[model samples]
Target chain A: MTQNLDLTDIQGNIVKAYGSSGFFKARYLFLRVDDGDKGRDFVGAITSKVTSANEKLKGDDALTVTTNMAFTYAGLQALELPTASLVGFPSDFVMGMSKRKDILGDDGPSDPKYWDKIWQEKVHIWISINGKTSDVVEERYQWILQQIKATGGVTLLRGHCGEDGNGNAVDDLPYQDASVLYEKDGVTPTAKEHFGYTDGIGDPVFDGQTNNAARVIGRGKLTRSGDWVPLATGEFILGHVDEAMEYPQTAPRPDLLSNNGTYMVYRKLHENVGTFNKFLDEQSKDYPGGKELLAAKFSGRWRDNGAPLVHTPDNESKAEWDKKFAAADDATQKRMLTDFTYNEDISGAKCPFSAHTRRINPRGSLEYGVKDAFHTPGALVDRRRILRRGLPYGKVKDETSDKGNHGIIFMALNADIKRQFEFVQQQWINYANDFKQGNDKEVLLGNHSSKDPGKVVLQVEPGSGKPPHFVNNIPRLVETRGGDYFFIPSIGALKLIAGGLVDPT
Target chain B: MSNIAGKAYAMNVITPIPWYKVWLNRLIFWAALKIPNVLNGLLTLSLIHYARWVIIPRDKFPRLDPSQPKEDLNYSYMLFFSNFNGSWDQYVDSFTFAIPSGLDLFWKMNVKYPKSVPLTPFHNYIQHNQIDTAHYYNAYPMAASNDVKSAKNVKKALIDFNAASSNKSPDEFLEDYNKLLNQLQNDFGEMRPTPIVSLAAQAVKERVMEEQRQSH
Candidate 1:
């Protein structure tokens, strides 16, 4: 990779998504600062321990546990940041997630009141402890608790692990735990979400971010020349030039504080597995090819193996794909998982146009039937990519009931929350005009509480002479439990906040 | 979407023009004002309640109070306001696709104005300078520009029909009514509260409701 970033300054989470890259277990802690001086002391103490985005760990150098921290607008204000620095921040970050619920398509059941009590209150500091195992996660969690206890300046906000299968009381826990789902054997881990679809497949690779330059194809912006090169660094990191050819708006004074930093969208999305399972079961009954095919249509991937429907259109071919993917080498398999595009199935005959994955990413599918719709293939999609993190929380006790707290602690890292995370949430997931799917909300993530909960159209296979399958009256599969926009600043920024050396002049 | 009132979206964009280059933009707007046909492409689109450009010279900025310091800005500002009937992207893409040269002519003099052909840059440029209206008001929150025009057309047609053939024989009046129906078919749509058909429509409905609530 050319143009290496100042890895020592950036947060390690931006460099690598800890959840996807081996850190299966994670603990998230929220804290409030009543006293600014003591808060600074706590920050100073954490700054030294906080992980930086250094080189990728290989073999023996791999970390068993990693720590990263971020602050909400309330958190920064609680830390007594200068007004200039605070005002210089973007309006969205200033408003925080609670105030911007309408902009985020969060209403009705996903309303702010429905959120966990921790989210209902003002959260200042967010501490994430990620590790290779549950024990390691607990160790780091205890260590952080010790830090909070020692500081005496910041109050540890009781977390709401409402979905944690441990039967923890709501808003009474010290921290929330998120872990990757275990296979049927309960030994091996899988990358599937509560909905049983493989999520977090193709996050964007920006310049100077990752060493694997080979991972650009279908992961990075699709170029007019058809080469899949890394996106501009500023798309994910501050101070660097972005896809818009402008440095991202940063806190002006003491530029070092804002430089090498990025914004994080922390959302606790609770998946209603019972409602989801029931919907699929009922829909698949009369579905032309039954449950498996219907499941693939709901998402754009085969449920059992996460094989993209664009790669394998039908059951017979999906069998072949499973074999090929199983036999392929590590590099080939990695490439195979995310390399497919919408160039083949432009008509949505294979993968439905309104499929959750297809609508979310599009993968240059906007140009399938409508030629010259975009200046470049996936030009609009490229700028909106977010570095996906977070893990599924709680345990699924009953497979049929919507109760009992199980969902994903969804985390998104990006340069601009409004341009990246909010745009994706509002336009792509909650609305369907961009995908030419009329007003259909995404089947999995759409806010479906209104009189008209949107529908999905599964385009029939070409030459089959069958009409398109219509999946109507889709329910809200996921809800916003609670979360907010956070700013994961650089190492230098933390020091500035700690020392109160943030001179806007 | 908050700028939306019924089917109309009020877009306000302010871009700085270098003092030296202000005359070129002045000449263009002036020429368009004189030759109204210069905006025929925009008129044909029929997507606006009102659209105007006001140029504020750098030194001419008002200082309302004595305590308010006099401004010392180097660049004059071009304020473009359009109350259009579509989403920002729809109106912009239509402008770029239908009248690229027209958009270029209007915005080319402004600083960092990208030519409208490649849309990403152009969209960003407008969005960067575009100001969201904190409070927007429309006389008719439920009527689009088309609705107003169609209503006017229907009224005029009805008056003329009444004046020309009101006292005709029954058979003759029936023939005249048929002719009138044939001619006025395009103006037959009834205006009502904007439907929640799309994302913007939903926003409009909410905004209208909010305005109605506040008024009460």
Candidate 2:
């Protein structure tokens, strides 16, 4: 609503979270600038090589190369940038992970200590390179590494597996190894996290992007008459009018550094595949509809095909639903992907209130509170929408003995870190009661601490006058391994930092 | 036979008038409620709808406006951070009344409240304030003086508010909030209380002084 985005000034990653970037493979390199002068040179070098939002890839043969970077508070300081330059940066970044650990719930593997040891050091730069093929990704990564070596910067942590110079198995090496490998069941391609639920289903559609038709039908609340509208762009990007019809607070000097720049919450989430499988296996035996339905209930979607549980309630319709989903046209398929709202299933008869998806993005269901409790059907949830650009790391081994380090590089981009990311994490994912269901945490993907024994209750209404089915004591499935708050600066801002021209006053 | 037929036609025409009028009356009633300013009655009804359904229901909490200069807005924000205490529900209920009441008081005091004042009584106050929770983590640290001490007090007040407000009636909750407001005013005085309370207090004080001068 404010203005058209300066695509050329913005980083490619911020504009498009790269879910559609056909770049099936990616490697994240964490770097620490050894010397300020050398770091500036390195930044300049990388800034030239970095792709802007306006970059256009020609064809399948041309590798879709995109590089975007962000700095920690220390990273800016390490580069000798002035304090004035850090104005709009969130305090979490300034306090660093060590100080903000309490609110982040990063006491476990996600603990700052277990974090890529480099992150603990005076690490300043984070470079993410993504490409269609691993070979292209490797080639680009090596060239960037060579430049860093020449410039006196050191690579702190390397995520994803690829052969080192010694030809050792990348998987065999022990470090913070995380990867984005595709999961396909024969012909159908399923982009899933280690937990086996299809991931990245309902990303928020912003204005001025392609996929207008899909955005119109899929975005915002679905009324009883079956109409929809896109969420305000300011909710995702900086310098735009949000749903509130007001421009969101920018990170200081709107025109220079803050415009088009958004904050990214980089998280490393480890999935306990063995524990999850065992719990589901044991619980499904006593469950009313067994493992398939139980998994659907937990995730709000069918594990095999990302069909929503609201659309297909039981396992009996699984085969028919799968076939229908597979046979549908592109438009029909896109509609199936995000067209459904919780209006009809207000009681959570189909999708439980505490279901992972429902909790994260309640959509229209949040309106079902006390009279005049919310502005509109989905108004309460509009501000909290995040563009998820996460990729599953680690290979899933056998269900029982899956013991290797595997999880997801959970990445989310939003305009305001506190309002969108932290609010969703703390209120919806960790705490309960906003749903008015109970003290139940999100059934899956919640911060269910072992000490707390996070309990989840599933209410299933069959409508036959019979009592609703209730499941409790759902175990903690995902754990925060490591994460940090970063301000992904605009390309121009990056250049300013690289040139050491940022004025403090 | 002709006379009998003519009499029957007249009876049929008269019979349909009441039924048509019944349907018309129902349409008029429906239109009065929904169609927006059909009559003066509809206009009044629409205003009520706007107030209850739109303004009250929406999240009106103070937000950081990108358009506004940062340095100027920080004082009010500091007060906002200083004033908050307790569970999300309590905070929402507090603001639901506090914001409107504060504005009403401000208006009564004949002070010009900023145009941005209306943003404070939001629909999703709980979620909006939860964002302030990031301040606890120092995610977006306020540059205000004594922020750390102020934050600690706010957290304690939140716990106290939750404990006090739970299971209390609306009147009971209001009384508790009033006590909290007084305690905050006493504890911080002019130095650290929320701007809302400070402004309202100043307004009331000024009014009293004027009244006393007139009496003299």
Candidate 3:
């Protein structure tokens, strides 16, 4: 009942999460097509540069620099894709993220008006270049600039004309940079985001997505008999049957045009570090376990490392748990980071019900009350799983200021946006009653306004004899600055769009 | 507060149906009830616990009190209610996907009803007409609809196994128990409490525990 994913068909970044591949520096640019023929020529020129899943990465032909391209609905239209092919695309992708704001809860301060000035006008194409070093990233970006220059039809879409410290206009290249956070030595990437958490743990392992067969244990679906099985490849990739064992009705046709394609949700989330720290400082006062425990309660993961609260259980144990992590072997360390479930702590004593990670993944915890309720505990969540394809954009220069340009470039890859991505945002992150929290939002992404007066419960085991602390006045953690949905087409589809071979008739 | 009981949440939606289409809608429901196979796609969706549709004709609006004004409506109203597991999005999206034609046939005649395609408009249509449940009750708060049905099979298997094992030797009884386990492997697990039903509930439990500790 499983089909081996055609690795050669998938786009490079879709298969390989760039950070782990030692590509720390990334440059992102959007290009708009002014002339159709030149746009097609531009696509044709970049076709060879676009990395594929089967590209040789480890040896002499090593991928020192990686490039990938995706298109907005407007971009596809600009490329002059046929009407039939265009109409077959999913409604969410066609509507773009800004138009779907109501469904996405992108209201209040996170509205489209607050987006990056570049997003004021919709752009046609999105281009990303990832590299091992700054020189490589810049070189690739410059080469792309050449392509835009050479093709008279294409032009770089610029962002806010904000001044650099020297009083010179910045974003002149009309690009954004996202790099992995580095340790103080600044030589090695720590894979930590601005918040000082060891991020990117527990990415889903679909069948045939990677060579790491062992990843299935913690990353894959847990079956009725307690066996770990990889999820259907179709959950993340198009042209295949998803968890529902049915091809989505919206998969674009002239089948080759949509096959191996997936939707990417690009969001610029602004992290209010100062507000977060101040809130922690304020709330940790007169608290039993202090700020560390409160921080753990927010995400269900220890901020020092990515250790789940399930393993630590309490403040003392968590402190000790962090120490053992570094000394452990690769296998043990990976297990410590990714493995474990919320079933044992059924009351959310260890991991609060509204914890950010729990709200996002839930990881079969939603069915914890009754074991074997479904053949697989994660049946409900399996379909909603999304591949997080994002990186932290800006550096944290000042830790004390809530006002700064520092946050995550949160991109999500999914087969169905409305079903998987939108559902998670609307049903889990924005709303309550799903996790039995009664309108209380997830702590980190709660978008808490003063009127709502962000309040939440942090519980300890009843056996510990501590009353659940009701934390009050939680502040907004993240706000959306800009983003839209883009379609990462297969190489085959790219060729079709480039050749003007996509036919609806 | 009462709409949710453990895994199931009750949803109620009432929308006006055109007078001309009311009978046709009723006929569709009657056909679905009589010919169960027509609902094969819906039954396959698996999340729905129970669903029913009722039509109240414009003239049928009840008038009980003299003080209450008699109803004179141009359109009959159709009421749809269901108890289902998971979030509202999953329930509706699954319904739309599982049985697009069936959903259209059921909701096709309602006033300003959008067809169940290009999802947002359809979602808006339902949300516009939906009414929150004031009170809802479920006998098995800890179990899903499937759990309740499986429990029945488990009970029957246990009764038969108990009767057959009465006269067996120790080894034979062990063998009989293994056979019983094999027959009901899926029904072996018991339902436990889901993490923190509500913060209010957790607060109450914590306060009671604190008081007990103080008294002790």
Model 3 regions more than 4 Å off: A160-173, A462-465, B1-80, B83-89, B92-216
Candidate 1 regions exceeding 4 Å error are A163-170, A250-252, A368-373, A461-465, B1-3, B7-216
lDDT of 3: 0.77
Model 2, residue B183: distance off in Å is 42
Best candidate, DockQ: 1
Runs off by more than 4 Å, candidate 2 = A1-3, A57-63, A153-179, A183-189, A220-226, A316-320, A369-373, A462-464, B1-110, B115-216
CA error at residue B21 for candidate 1, angstroms: 13
Query: What DockQ, on C-alphas, does every prediction get?
Result: 0.05, 0.02, 0.03
TM-score of each: 0.78, 0.70, 0.74
lDDT of 3 by residue, A153-271 (tens): 88788883234556454644388778888889988688777776667787888877766656776688767666667887778888876765566555788889888988999888888
Error of 1 at A430 (Å): 1.2
Candidate 3 pairs with clashing backbones = none
Give the distance in Å from residue B125's predicted Cα in candidate 1 to where it truly belongs: 7.8
Better of 1 and 3 by TM-score: 1
CA lDDT, candidate 3, residue B53: 88
Local distance difference test values of all predictions, in order: 0.78, 0.59, 0.77
What are the interface RMSDs of all the models? 12.1, 17.5, 14.0
